[model samples]
Target chain A: MLKAIQNLGSSTTTTTRTTTGFVASFYRLKPPHATTTSAFVSISSSLLSYYSPRTRPTKPLLFLTRKTLSLEPVRAHSTRSESKMDDTSSSSSVAVQSSGSVRKINFCQWCGGQTKHDIPDGEEKMRAICTVCGKITYQNPKMVVGCLIEHDNKVLLCKRNIQPSFGLWTLPAGYLEIGESAAEGAIRETWEEAHAEVEVVSPFAHLDIPLIGQTYIIFLAKLRKPHFSPGPESLECQLFSLDDIPFDSLAFSSMAVTLKLYIEDVKAGSRKFHYGTINKRPGTSPSDTHGYTLVNHLQS
Target chain B: MLKAIQNLGSSTTTTTRTTTGFVASFYRLKPPHATTTSAFVSISSSLLSYYSPRTRPTKPLLFLTRKTLSLEPVRAHSTRSESKMDDTSSSSSVAVQSSGSVRKINFCQWCGGQTKHDIPDGEEKMRAICTVCGKITYQNPKMVVGCLIEHDNKVLLCKRNIQPSFGLWTLPAGYLEIGESAAEGAIRETWEEAHAEVEVVSPFAHLDIPLIGQTYIIFLAKLRKPHFSPGPESLECQLFSLDDIPFDSLAFSSMAVTLKLYIEDVKAGSRKFHYGTINKRPGTSPSDTHGYTLVNHLQS
Candidate 1:
């Protein structure tokens, strides 16, 4: 595992196996030009001590590989995972603070021109307008696709290896990529997170978590085979009966509500589908007791 | 109606009543400093003639207000409406061309700093990275919410007064706002376009049009009263029996399929809810016969 971390570095500086049998891989931080020398040194020292062998045993090992690092900055897993591993929560705090500001463009990617923020003629909202190339940039909500996989009277749950809910169980889901249908995205996320093939039955839940700027489209799917294992983003993948579900440790409130709805419907013997919205109050942790409110319930 | 158009201009520059008695209001083009002279002249000439009274009779009267301009650049409605009113299609063509390019930020909206476009350290895709503020900007899909309103054995339809499918019939719908539930957005749109309140019964159809980067959530709804008329975004609102339904003139393929499903289910005495996706092939008009394919179906 230490060798894997060494490979992640562009050029490895040192590698050592500690007395505790944990590998310590150290690489020089390639700070961007804008990073101050003092800031770089401070960040590096903190990172080093955080990854030292003494601190390794208690932390989840999911972030030790490059595959897990492929998740984007906007994802809940990325924010949560990094905050836990790093002793300082400054980075995660910065991300959270920036979420409130409008997404502004500083330089044009096409012409490298300075941009202005204004509502273009005939447009309603303010947009980033290129000062040189006259290009207009817009921001929209992202689609997060996942599945509620059911098999043999049990639902599949993966113990997340990354943050925002590291070590907590969740349905297999991730950000939808460009050029894919919602169903395809959901199936892909399931396979990527759980190493399981699924046959999507139907669209089960449409949740708009506007606070995170994501609209999660969850499908009710069936496991194609009984075999399953944890993928890079998951520490463990297992089938949990209703009685065994860990509601307290669910990764997201949306997942908890979805699972609860599914369980209750199953008990009633009338498994109707649901579509609605989930809103998390500002400044409240998603896992907070009063954090999220389900505003609408549409059942069929 | 002509008087309404005159009121739209900040300062009345030129207003002409044509032989058809339609008022053509032309405002001076206030191009941004970055816009090239030739581009401004070309865009203005086309826009002027498009809104001219001679061309007004054939088009839907949707673009007669500032509220409609609040629609974003990502929507098919914006592209279609602009092209129809502009006459030359050059503006629409320019928008289509820009769609393929990355959304660039030239000046950071937060700190007025330079920005770069590159795949961020841990992400799979390229994004705008602010140099001064260290902000990462991301683009995502937009949600379009609407309703399938039924009353007294008749389905309500609105003749769109806006562009894209101007003059064509459609269920009342619009872009989902920043802080609203999908059901709230759908109900609001129905009221805004048809002057009728509706109780959203359940989720009816979930269609993902990856080509336009939209996820449309349609609901089964009930009209609160027998009274409705054309709202600002609609030219005519009426209830059509199954035999009188206008399939060929429906505004969107997803709407057509949803209506068809509703009709078929009603005839079978099983108004089961449907969940599925609709994918449109690239470069094909949405109205094209082979443009859209429904991938999966889940009924209850």
Candidate 2:
């Protein structure tokens, strides 16, 4: 069901690794239609503009170009059964039951009665409605909360001990609980995953991954003390300087984007809170697959 | 099933009218345990501090105090059948199926099969599990998006044509769509409810009413032009200056608090975006019932 094609270049070639555990060759595909511009091409164009020859060296620039373009294919399958499999391969902590399996809500939880999938009155979409109780069940996006803890120019990271990216590094984050603020949830998750105590400064990023039906609210926090250890959910916990970040082994795309933004903002001497949405678009190639747009930019 | 107990004052008794058409007398009851603090008392205390005498005059203060406190009983019944009735009295546009009845989901919607009301595997809450297809049905909080549109020193207000608060004025807002950003949802709802085109300035308020399972995200916006008419959901649409706002006939509690905060900020000569949460607490008196807390205050 999965295949990797390598396009080798003379003297210098860039390879990117995906969650599928295969390295794919980096190549830009021309737009199939003349009038339509693909998101992949736009991203690449922007990346080329962002990493100009006057600003940075060539080696790291090539690495970043490959890394950003690699997100397309994984995001393309985000709404399909293949996407579920990709998610499982990347992070077993998600709530997907199985890959390539049909999900159907056949029973009503309120009365132990049969249900029918149909559109309810005054609603735009189809829902699981109970035949006996006349109650319509709604499924909303789940919220994931995490913190970007900065202590003496180092950011805290945790290595997963569980499936879905076993041994892969990630920021301390998890599903939000009921009856708690987003900031509170982020703080709690940080403590639970990395055993770190940190005070949240403000909301840093709000990314909506609609394909997976999850919204991530990340907060910028200050470490209370330099003390830290791995919690039950983590294999190891440690702080790393900006230069030592494992960009390739990161568990999620949102984390990578956030870290990159933070680094860029710090380098520019203007660090601010950012809120944006990440959406995956249908495209012909991996490079043209995903679109990340910043809707609101606020400085704190 | 309905009773109203009035504690008449000697000569000047205050009577409050509920959306249910009941004119209940306003009276304060001490907590059952004097030493123990209920959410209601805490809210009242905080409200007293928030509405200190130094900020404004005490004439309209009584009405503000009464309005904030009136949320207690409705919130108290939010988890019960009576709460549904209260909601029907206030706004009929909500997604609740029935009023004054126990809601149950008896049948499964996915496969038209029987369902069991039980906790699914690896979950903390009980859900409607499917009998045949084995899908767990999950219900989550709905997102309510709206805009606080300001133009020429006036804010837009819409009179609701639907039930639950028929004829009561409200800010243009509605349930958010699955695949749209919160700001986009707010803008769409504004157009749908008031026939107005607005450019969103920033997120102004985020109120979580877990009692009714809703999180409201209200944005501060500016009207593109002075063009507006009543939409299908609205009976009338008009702009109201700060002095002309109808606090007594507003549809929801959060709207009242947002307006109040806006006024207070304007008065303090610091007109900036505010992000906060409003929580309703169980109170003894209807006028001392709910609390609003500013968890994170940032000036932008």
Candidate 3:
């Protein structure tokens, strides 16, 4: 099994096997639905340790769960048993992320049809056009909604227990789900990561990270009370004042930007809605330093 | 071909044929990527006219494009030529829209593998689990970002040329895409629908409609110049003050809510950030009577 995993022809295939093993290894790692890159790195590290000769370069993404899953399985299986194994391990890898997949939508999830990247009659740009059914799959930006909860003039932060940036402080946020409003999604993320109930004050920040195709909607909220602990995604949930907030250790640039904005808002005594773009900082990974530079647009 | 179009086993299949005919009939209808139900209705009315004997009901959706593209054609073609066509026509119909497809991930887009809807060990709910690769797929909410441009106390409104509410008024908006910020998307929509350039002032509204799995992020902006015209998506572009606002002729609940809120904010002299949900009206088809009720959470 490990040999098969090791010999996985493409990185996409390797990642696929790594993810399936991680998913099948234990559900306690985190629900596969909300699996993070941190989980991938952790599981990948273990899987890599099992094989020394070939260390498949790990992708800094956990997009498997997003681009996978089929509603028509009999066809999926029949195709798999036929000639699809090579293609499935490869083609499905492009444009699959929580931040929303873009470009090279090569397969028709509807008809198992191969697609040609062509500009349909009136479109200015090329799209993955299914040869059989002529369907165009579009991947758009995903919203990461979260809360910057304040109680006693301090902000609530969760130390991430999972990968990409494990053991680092961050706001409680996740991809917005169906049947829930953005505010509802924010509240759910707070509860899931920090075990806290919060009353949203107003929209605090609308930070766009175009590089990764995500918009961070961070709400400024107040704790309902003082009651809190940690949920599955957190190692610890703590309240920190501006003086003590771990600016250097926040898991994401979005979190750091939100906290700094909160502090600035507090000091200025004038609360305004903040909207801006976050560009990656130079000479560093997205996790290094504060990780991003905030370029605010002129306020109305 | 007509019989095949008529006997398309599922409404999903019916819709698929209708869409293909519509798409193939003319790309001038609107680019399939940004297609709306108005196009569906226009085309379906023509399609339904052709087959009078069997009045297959038309769905009030244009979801075929978002769920139908495939990257692996060899597998897709192989699967479709076999038993997959019936399944594809039926299965690909669920959980797809501009507002984002949700529920029922049954086939692995990666492996053409069959999936079972199971609650993998620790999940709170059942998720589609791939029987072949053990991978899961998740669907989340989509965002409709637009601009609410105000100049001389009048807002720029576009008379929609597309369906569900053709000839009705609305703010210029569309699905947020992969490479831009919400504000940038709003700007692009404004240009596409109204042929106008505007400068964003601030994030205005983040309205959520859980029923449709969509969030609208509207920005308050001012037209850059006096220049304005109608784009393909609009029949006409006009500036309307609160008095002349066509509240009854608006296209969507989200547009109505945002306009009304703008009126309210003008009267109050406080342009506070609005965060709320717009639930469908009790007796309307989401297009009548301004189509929805706005329930705002207490402002922060």
Candidate 4:
């Protein structure tokens, strides 16, 4: 559900602002000025280390390797049929679709020319080929970057006021914006969701929810302070200790994995990078991760 | 340019293939059948360790913290204007464009409803909104996953027969497709560009080429075998020792950063994960990463 927690304003209270002559100009097509960045970013760690060349390297440690991660099978990972509620991003429609109904591309975004599904020269898959411009529309997975912040020995959780998971608890994470790094996206999501500041300690996990075409990059972080508030997308925000954490109502399988890993690391007193996948089971609420199988690369 | 090294068949030589009712049946709308994955994946490592409960955790190492990886201001990273030739992805037109001419969204890609740039209610940025369906189109950077393979004390490099960097040297990498993990994408790219299978040793570098809205995930890998040939996207695949690498003709600033990190680690006799940004100098060839400044998070 990451796409930066997507579409903040309620459609009912809506007012459409226009730009580019057809609409009143609320935003210039030029991106330099972000009209929506309300939260100021302040972090504790230096995500950008001003480069000074150094040669010393330490002893190499153990590294995990994956022999083959196949994509040709029935992808048993989809244990249940996906519900539309699971994906709320407007952009999610650009790619992967339900077998029952795929969003057909009838026109090209590049040239506005009528398009049809056809394999172009040398290509193997059917693409939305523009008859006029002869261009193809390509879609891929989106990256959701966020942080798992620890402050005062507690974890921050947002009760989503948003539709995707409605009232479930989730980490402050969203789509990684253009021209931004994973760390920047993580910090931004934290601010936008919880109205709290955080400094990224390290990237904790890069988990792929391939069924939904999303890659969640969660960073281990610390609150800049103990203060926080709920942003537009959240009904409320609260900090909870391990015992009080809502394991059952967690929003996404990715979130559950992250929190569990954090708790494991917390108990073992170790922190390391994890790469893996979550195979979601069918007929479960979007918030429920029970029965989901996790494939963690580091452990293997 | 890594959208799977983009369009493999030369347009002039491409034979328009079709599926569905309109075109020749080369593929099905359903994805289970990958009409194009020709190579068999053979890996030396286990990408997915089947999960098992474990109690003990390893020692936590020095974790680099990044205070703020900012996204405001002029974004000094673009020391020069980027050339369109650098991006060969058909989907590149979906988002991020030259200041002179941005791609206009005239219709909703979902419903083919005529669209115009407008700020939806509660949102600040002007999105291409479908007047009929009342939907929005959002775009984000793409993920490029590839690997740095060490085979017999030499590294693998592909001579691109494809554009954006034809004739230049590059590591085997391409766009991370939907329903694919970063490691799988890396291995797939290795097979596609070099016709060589590799086992991902570990995630080596994750660098964001934000200027182009790209995040490159490079893994340290060992080729499954010494045998390899150029795939469709490459003119020739070759192995080069560190001393013979074509430093100047290397394609993509991100590639430069990845290789440099690999070389540095090689000399130091240690392998570590790296994350950072590459500020590509303007007016320079896409392959020419000279004068570029690298801000490495881990090194910082």
Candidate 5:
């Protein structure tokens, strides 16, 4: 998709790195540094020119319009369902289930389903307590960053020092800082976790994993310097070839999908771009690593 | 631009309504829809495939990257000294100024410099609190929406419902809702303000009047149905011919820009999409009009 967009007669280019792959080409685009950027202004104005003739005073043309692109009613995805909570006027009720049990049980962890549990310990309980609002406030996920860095045809990998995956190898990624754009956050994470100066490439992968309460956007990037030392939060940071990727040691199932996608891009050659999971059929793997999961090969 | 994009081929039509002058007749391809959208996806993808095979896979394509897009810098019209407020943390200070004969000056609205008289009342102070983080918030200009609706070779427009031009003519446009997509909101505004069921023909106009705290995107739309009844908000909604556009009664200077753009698009026989101000040039109109406020163009 990056290649296709680039080939649209646009003079725009990435300034971050000099990678040839479309995914790796984002590094060449100049960073937004000054409050007023001359280069950005010029490109934007030129791109606008591409649309200028259309708005010029002349004969009007017939246009096609639709309420919906497709007649098919979209089935609700888990992420869509989760986002709905944010849209409601106020937080709404959500039934909590422990594990996979279907029993109707809503007792507080601090205090079981008893009247005493509702009483405050020292200060009087606030009369304006809304349980639904409380639940939503407690469960909102922070924005997280994920990246794939390349060096000498090998991809960089790191083992997270935190739990959920204390030892499994993963991409050099982390949460975003306040007031920073996603791309900037991704680069900052690459630096902090991998201790490497890397150029961010095109945004190639987006995965919304509702089960784990996370939305991961995996970017393809190029390492400015291949030599990187692991930061304190990383158990280790190292490069691995496609064949040598530690599939068994992968942390989240999403990482497997990310890797599988990178492999497909490698195989599809230059024109390989969008791998949108928007229309993935139901019952399919949320990660969509159908034939590529390590467990699948291990089981066979 | 859209016609050029649509009729990339088709040698038969030379300078027809659908023909963008610069496009190649050989590239014309019929769209699956009544209007051709073939170039939007397929042609671009095919173009990406034409990249030179020998091009290094690791080198960045400058045009495709953001760094190379040249956008203009914001020119400062004010002669005030360049001073930045360093208050990301928690300190507050007061600054006073004496203007000529007036010794008791007020607050500096642009820099958050407060004056003794600027001290806030409890409720007014509360109003300034940021809802997102519960802190005093800086003022920001609100966003507005605008639209161009076409019917019977004429375009639909509305008279201003508010000041600075209490009753000037302009396209039916307004502010965007919190979470609305730019295009979606533009369409919705047309329906609400004009009582017209219209299809968005092509996006071709924009205006960003930061001095007055406004940013707007104007779209050209095909009137889906001529039968429309003015909604409660609109004083009147009607069509105006190209030759009969009420130039003197046009709402804001930006509205004049949209009208001029629409006229140019008709002459150019295509859509001209743009960002920032509708006219690309700086100060195209000296002493531009500020208040032709078109409000609530789109509902969430």
Candidate 6:
């Protein structure tokens, strides 16, 4: 088992072992996610460790008992293993159960598949397995991440080589890689698509796209050297000032939202971190009771 | 097929189709990743989608064309199916060979695991894929998030539930969930373990924990309606003033680092936001510069 370990805060190690007892390691750990400021309140990883994959059923019987007695109802697992081979455009239902207490009858919450393993085991928790992936699907939020690469007075952008927007221009951004820090992935992505050597400055934006099942953290970074070339993943690479941004040609709604916030920050001469993505357009204040709706867009 | 679609900013409909033809749509979509910010950014499913369960070589080409010839070197794939039952403890290697291009091996630059994947024929741009999970892994940063639940001038504290210093006392905090927004998750976590609802007043502390695959984002929230019960996640929950904090029993190296910063900020009256977690600590800062070193304290 080769182990690649990077320590954050202090010297600590995390090891993953292969049968041959090989270990791999990584270093200079930074916080996985951050805002414009890296100064966050301290929270330990004790509780987080409970959710680790290696976490066993410590008192499985107690957990089972709690499962059986919970107020929620468990449905029967009704579907079989049949690959939903149709195009993603084709509609199909395969029910998958979530590990959590909540269970809905009609469909799997995450993938919109039919509920297959909705069995009320001795424990009250109903398990719905997805007919498509054969794994239990639950309403889990997706991870979103991206980088803000600034060179000179302009920002670098890429015309996506993939879809849902194939040829749209945007920053180098994507989802968080498992066991990777958001900053590391962001910098890595910058290198991959834009072929640029960059230094992550600070985390700038954090937003939640509830509609699409993602949470995003956009970071501010500067190119170590301005020289760059487009990678296979990018159709084109170029830099643009705030006014010259190709607004209509940007990919995904969130990118547009982030860019808008970035421009606003620059205009206001404020570099503080901002929450809520353009996708959700969180109301004016975090403590407001407007019930998560947009009152209006602040006209530039 | 049940579809969970959100409202598109433009006319683009957030439509999801299931394998079955029945689609149930939600008018107001849930935030993508539990947090109230950011949209989900995923790799282009169309261009990058490969090695599906149904992947099969079609009819051999009769005449190789220019574009096909250009892409020929990328067609090379390992004939080995993903090993489902191999001993996970053993180290492995994955190599991609194209006709004329240099053969590339997929492994972690840090731990040397067979967890790297070439990015769709791109050179020096492959993701580290975890062999055990058969998914790509990145040497990423860790996230450290926690809440500041204060009552009267005193704040809440708890002994470590699990960990390096299991009985150490500190403020309640943990990792961000898979699909949760940091603030929402932080607040929800405070209520879950501390049985308290606190409005996060200002950004507090941010620490980059690149070493142990962690980052810390601590929020300074004010307590509201203090009546509460300690959930199962905590060992004990109590309130303490700055003078009353148990520095000796604090959990995790970062907690002391955070508390010091917190106190510094409190004293300086700089409630806006701080940059690093333990910049005040000299010895602990090395891991911050060199990445986290894994320790055995995490083992159950």
Q: lDDT scores for all predictions?
A: 0.53, 0.49, 0.53, 0.54, 0.37, 0.40
Q: With candidate 6 superimposed using the best TM-score fit, by how many Å does residue B154's alpha carbon deviate from the native?
A: 3.0
User: Largest TM-score belongs to which candidate?
Assistant: 4
* Candidate 5 C-alpha lDDT tens digits along A1-300: 012111111112222211211111001112222112333222111112112232223212222211110111223322211221111111112111100011112221111221111212221111111233221001112234567886777899987765445566778775432222344446666766787766554444534332222335455667665568787667899899988998767765557667766775677663122221111122232223221111101000
Which one wins on DockQ? 3
Scored against the true structure, residue A271 in model 1 reaches a CA lDDT of: 67
- Output the better candidate (3/4) by TM-score: 4
CA RMSD for every model? 20.6, 15.6, 18.4, 20.8, 22.6, 21.0
lDDT of 3 by residue, A24-140 (tens): 111122322333344233221211111222111211111232111111111122211111001111113322432233233445556667767554553333345678877665555
Q: What TM-score does structure 1 among the candidates reach?
A: 0.65
Residue A209 alpha-carbon offset, candidate 2, angstroms: 2.5
DockQ of 1: 0.12
lDDT of 6 by residue, B1-300 (tens): 011121111222122222311111111212223212122222111112221222122111211111100111111221111110010111122111101011122332223335434442222224434354342322223244677665776778866454334455656676444323455556655765677766555445555432223456666666656665665556788888888877656655455556655665568765444333121111232112221221101000
Q: State how far residue B13 of model 2 sits from its true place (Å).
A: 25
DockQ of each: 0.12, 0.12, 0.16, 0.14, 0.02, 0.04
lDDT of 5 by residue, B1-300 (tens): 121211111112122121211100112222312322231212211111112233223222211111100112223221111101100111111111100001122222112233232212321111122122222212222335556777787988776454334455657665443222343445556666666656544445434432222345566566655666565445677788999998767655666666765686679775544332211122222113331222111100
TM-scores of the candidates are 0.65, 0.62, 0.67, 0.68, 0.33, 0.51
The reply for model 6, stretches above 4 Å from the true place, is A1-143, A178-180, A277-300, B1-144, B161-165, B206-208, B274-300
Off by over 4 Å in 5: A1-143, A210-213, A278-300, B1-300
Of candidates 6 and 4, the better by TM-score: 4
Candidate 4, residue B241: lDDT: 94
lDDT of 4 by residue, B1-300 (tens): 011111111112112211200011111111212222222211111100110012012111112222111111222121111121234122334333311012256667677788766545644334567778776655566778888888888999988876566788889887775555677677766776787866666667777655556788877777665788998878898889999988878766667777877887789987766665554443344565563555425421
The fraction of correct interface contacts reproduced by each prediction comes to 0.27, 0.20, 0.35, 0.34, 0.00, 0.04
